[model samples]
Target: MTPLLVAVDVGTTSARAGVLTRDGAVLARAEAPIEIRREGAERAEHKSENIWASVCRAVAEAIAKAGADTETIVGIAFDATCSLVVRAKDGAPLAVGSDGDPDWDTIVWLDHRALAEAEEARATGHRVLDFAGGALSPEMEIPKLMWLKRNLPKTWQRAGYMFDLADFLSWKACGSLERSQSTLTSKWSFLAHEAEGWPADFLTAMGLEDLRERASLPRHASPIGHPLGTLTAKAARELGLPKTVIVGTGMVDAHAGALGVLGAFANQPETIDRHLGLIAGTSSAVTALATEPRPAPGVWGPYFGAVLPGIWLSEGGQSASGAALDHIIRVHSSGAAPTPLMHAEIINRITQLRSQCDDLAPRLHVLPDFHGNRSPFANPKALGVISGMSLDASFDGLCKLYWRGAVAIALGVRQILETLNARGYAIDTLHVTGGHTRNPLLMELYADATGCTVHELPDADAMLLGTAMAAATGAGLYPSLADAATAMRHASVTREPDRSRRALYDRDYAVFLKMHAHRAEIEAML
Candidate 1:
């Protein structure tokens, strides 16, 4: 029987699973929604059990759809958002939010409740920040932990184990306490290239001196594709797979997507910096890998071995992309739920309008920092700005705003690209995969606005494919992660930038930068 691998990806609102052959062709896929409990604007929580249950549902459904015998499923792996999962020593969930519900034990990655804590961490001036874009983000694990310790003292006292969401999933799979190098290095400030991954003095400075022991973190992190062990009987039964299935180390979701798209260039280390991976969905993450550490302020990384071993990875992104579009629709007078049909209609109208005119909303400008700016500026408190609005409350008005929003999103990617290039990367190609691929307007803008070749893998879900590559290595189907990647990677359809649109986008980009300065000036006065 041919060996198959199961890959699970847990995002903010759902868990997706895919069953793939050893060669990287996905045989089946499934999805299940997970709940997010939001308290006001700055806090979000997830139930660990609910997330695991969703994962189990998606995995079982995918295997059933694939019609593969349980015996043929030899490996499983996971990738998830960099949310923090807290638990008791006995492995039961512990509440992390104010609701006091034990089920809501995980902090969502976008939660900014730790903004103050993140600032405190930045104030320490520790060497750990050297790898972290010269500052700390509330989205990272340390600040979130600090927030929990300072605000929920009772929960902190009861905490015995903490894991990055991906590590938590791996532990649930095979009952292993091991953590992935990707998760630790990218989200938890673990310096993979150093003798000591975790700096004791730095944690001490941040008032997290006992964090390692409290979280049960291992001194050494397991590299990506390293097999933790076979699935536990309980996990195997729940997932409808055999206990012999190997459980591979997990990764952050964006990192997994990076591996999926950039894995083909793994052997071409000298020119890897010429390519970037844009895993854009609810948010947009631009991932670039280089042969050496190339640190840039406000760009997260130079994370060693976060994706490929011995390669440094840097990430910069907009905290809101698709989500910003959804918000624009939701707030508009002629809009509803921002469903697929609705978005398609808007895009169709915009396309028609652009055919007749040079631009749909030429005067309208948008700064899509509604959720906050994650890159270039690294300002989490930043607010979105929309210029040139009128009393137009018709459907066309909504379409105009939506079109400008998409343009802003693409412009943000261009800014991030410029920053990366300035810091030593020569990225000229963008390998894009995610929900944004479905939007025709965004797809066209990605290439034209950014002036880079955008390669879209239409046949593959890069996140799932990347996780499957890790599973293949863990199952011994390949000798190394790079080998698995090279074998299973998909061909791409390239979209070259339209040179005619260069002058238009250049003018808009100039306005985009000016809007940033104006927003800063207005905020300073307040």
Candidate 2:
């Protein structure tokens, strides 16, 4: 019987599962939306039970569609948003909100409810803060835990375990509490690069020493193919699979994308050390693998054994790329109303508007930090700045603003790459995948701005492919991630920078830097 691998990817908006053959071809795929609830300022929550249900549904649908025998599916893996999942003993939900509802057990990654707490934590001048790009944002796990202690003290006291969303799913499926170094070290401030376990002082500072007391921290929390027990009979029934399926340690969604593609360069004689994986999504992340650890300030990294078994992974990105564009388009125009035309129609209208533009936001450049700056300058408090806007509020003008905003974001990616290049990393090529990768104009702009050859995976769903790669490793079809990526990953299209527009962008990017610097000066004066 031909072996199959099943991968469950739980993202910010939905849960998805894909079944892939040994060669990395997707045989079946399924998705189910996960609900989000917001109660104003920085509060975003998802029900843990609902997320699990969606995962089960997506997995069942994909397996049924593939028509593969349950016994033929050799392994399972997962990837999810770096959201924080808190639960009480016996796996009961513990509210992570101010309203004190036990059902709200999750603090969605996008939630900024812990902003003040994050600021406070950063103000302490903790040495570990340097690892998180000099300033830690509330989007990370530690700040959320601190916020829980400070604001939701009762729930904090009741909490039995804290899990990054991916680890939580792994725990749910195989009943192993081992957290992946990818999520814990990258987002939770766990010290994975060093021989030391999680920093005791850091945990003490966050008042999460109880976690250490329970000895939940793993000695070697790096990503490994753990025979993490079996799919619980209960979960197996829900997913319509056999209870004996093996599960493995999983990674964050974007990290999985990195794993899926980074290995594609195997045996090509190109040094994989300098290759950077640009995984763009609602947000953008830069994942790079290196032989020795190199810590780039304002970039989160030197994560040990996060992706490849022995290589260090450095990750950095804008908190809002796709999200930023959506925000700019909505706020600059007539609210979030869907255009009378379809999405393609609206995109065409925008394209036409851009053709009529004389200059790229001659008087207008947006900072694109509406959410928070996640790279190079990890300042969450940095408010967005839109320089040089007139009183003209026409919809067409608004569309132009949107175009400028997308370009500005592309420039931010450039700024990040510039930082990396200066730190002795050679980023020669860009590999992109996600919902945003479908936007050809945006892809071209990214290539032009960064001056790198941007390649898109042939498979529309690379994250699914990535998770399946992990499962394939567990199924013993491939000896390593590199081997699987070579057979499974291929680039269907490539976008090169347009030299004709290089001079224009070169000037515009300088202005982009000036606007941000000038805004900082302007704000300081106030």
Q: For every model shown, what is its TM-score relative to the native structure?
A: 0.97, 0.91
Query: Scored by CA lDDT, what does every candidate get?
Result: 0.92, 0.77
Best candidate, lDDT: 1
Best by TM-score, which number? 1
| Candidate 1 lDDT by residue in tens digits, 241-297 | 888999999799999999999998998899999998998988888899999999987
Q: Could you give candidate 2's per-residue lDDT for residues 122-172 as a string of tens digits?
A: 887887775666667778888888777778778766777778898889888
Superposed on all Cα atoms, model 2 deviates from the true structure by an RMSD in Å of 2.7
Q: List the residue pairs that clash in candidate 1.
A: none
